[model samples]
Target: MKNIKYDFKSVIDRHNTNSLKWDYFDDDIPMWVADMDFKVAPAITESILKRANHPVYGYTVVSDELYDSYINWWNRRYDFKMSREDMLYSIGVMPSISSMIRCLTDIGDEILIQSPVYHVFYYVVEDNNRKVVENELIYENGEYNIDFDDLDEKLSKVKMMILCNPHNPIGKIWSKEELSKIGELCCKHDVILISDEIHCDLTDPDVYYNPFEVSSDYEKAITCLSPSKSFNIAGFQSSIVHTKNSELLEIIKTQLHVDNSDSTNVFATTAVIAAYNESEEWLNQLKDEIFENKQIVKKYLKEELPIIKLVECDSTYLLWLDCSALNVPSKVLSGFLRENQGLFLSAGIDFGKSGDNFLRMNIACPQKLLKEGLGRLKAGITALTIIK
Candidate 1:
């Protein structure tokens, strides 16, 4: 393992802390949720501590320093220049997405999403009384590719399209050309494009994901960004939306403001500023750790459980494992693993029907926990095979 300045191997006990990943299940190992089990950057904790030392916890305002932190981080890292005027603060990416769904589309309007994708894309559209049109990506030879023809056909029927760049579950990073084609199709169809890029900063070490706006000159695009996934400060509930279209921005701002999703909590701003400005090295180290965890899973899967295939991906710590060889549904397999081995991984069917043959495993934990999870997985699968 590479030497790291921060603690990534502590195996901190989260059972009684009201952690969603820990307390929600009786499973001994949870490789389910996207949040990292690693400790946050020292600077983030220090900033929060400094703020908490104050006597009062009151409503907070979004600071210019907070905006600059996001601006500088993007400019330095992705060469994506964003102005403060074009950006709007939100409590989270999902709330802002839900707000956009409510305001931008009419009842029964169709929305496009690529599958298998982040599961919430299904909820936000259907729950809002809008229809979902899936342009399922073509999966071939252990890789995922955009079906431009299908996307073009689907865009003609939808009012809006939600894109998951450096997508979750699959962990694939959409390329520049692919994003350009998507933008062109959306423009041709006059469809609104919402790019969920919260996972933009979690790529493999030295690998970078292309921001949607930077990859395409589509004016109808809204890019949702957050440091929560990258810096593991998700509990802070801070995110922002960037769009170059002033008219669309105004409409979105109004909807978010009306929905109360634009307000910030006391520590969200502090965490964002510290994460973007003072925690670059910590993020770099995290990328390395995730990379190592991926390698560990790959080696273990190949050696001990050749029945399961690890999908090839370049971004996000969430890994999509192909369990097609087991001839079992992902939901049943996931349940069996949890019941028999106390290992909880996400059932891929939750993302989309196309994902029923796969399982999504979150490997953003310490090596010790990752190894234990793998052990449980192997045990569960071995028993399942025996039953078969």
Candidate 2:
């Protein structure tokens, strides 16, 4: 393993494999969904194949090793200690979010979410019969900042709040102090905080994620972490939920049982065990490569498309592009790119109304494809600016 290069550059054809990222769009470059285009680590493939070779795909029981790997990984990377009893398993992170929402809040309760966040957070909030109260992030001078005064006011009324750490779309990694402050407000206001840390392992090279449980106010917080995003095994439908509030944890457990939302496929257990224990080197190399891809985006935006400003991103593979200078709504520009150039990215409006002039690009692919996407983006933006 001394001089061997990890294979993040080779583009794999995912057309016929039922890939959500590839198959969801028709022939266009699919940069919308979060799953990476790179193949998983060799260790993960070996584990899955080894399991496949076994004859019996019987009922699966998650073992203590599964819990241990999760704990060890968090302790090793984030210095957060988690106990086996505090760790719970759910089929998917989004489902777990819904289950917790239904269990913790009564009918017509309000859940807090920051605007211009991951679109799914808004979807689940409304879909679960709850009202969404937005504490929109402050965007000024080309950077996004937490609006503490607004958040404090919002938390005072809501029964629960869902947070995306290393926030999606914006890709801002919240510092320990920032997380503690949020945790403090939630604790003081008798509000429950559910954190989606699924993107924790995908940070840039020197950046790290702070698990919400590390704060003393964590008893009022619940965090969901997944190896699916980092390892690209989202189809496995496996995620871990860590909550320090034992009483609230019991309620979530009961709701999951009632909803039957806690089962993992046969390979999910093995994949998690392999991902946290044996995939550290692969992940480290991935972060460095992603950081390089981000640099390409930054340089391309500055030199080729100076009208669009790239927000400073500290973590996650998402690059938030502010296109207000182009004087076009993001939805219109998004349609133009998809129709004219066959380029598809998450429309900024999908995140929230405040993202009307923005777009989110996924840079977790090979450099060749990254450049290709950039070319399409530049061509599309130039055409739109001319039209305007």
> Which candidate achieves the best TM-score against the true structure?
1
lDDT, candidate 2, residue 35? 85
Report the lDDT tens digits of candidate 2 across residue range 1-388. 4355799999988898888888867846878889899989998999999999999998898789999999999998899899999888899899999999888998899999998999999989999899999999999998898999999998999999999997998998888889999988998899999999999888889789777777546577899999988988898999878887799889998998887887778999999999888888889899999999998999988898898899998889988999888777888888899987888888899999989889999988989888999999999887877787
Task: Give the per-residue Cα lDDT of candidate 2 at 246.
Answer: 90
Among these predictions, the greatest lDDT belongs to 1
List the lowest-lDDT window of 10 residues for candidate 2.
Answer: 210-219
Q: Which stretches of candidate 2 lie over 4 Å from their true place?
A: 1-3
Per-residue lDDT of candidate 1, residues 1-388 (tens digit): 2354888989989889899999987889998988989999988999999999998998889999999999999999999999999999999999999999998999999999999999999999999999999999899999998899999898988899999998887999889999998999999999999999999999999999999999999989999999999999899999999999999999999999999999899999999999998899999998999999999999999999999999988999999999999999999999999999999999989999999999999999999999999999999999999999
lDDT of each: 0.94, 0.89
Candidate 1 clashes between residue pairs 3 or more apart in a chain or in different chains: none
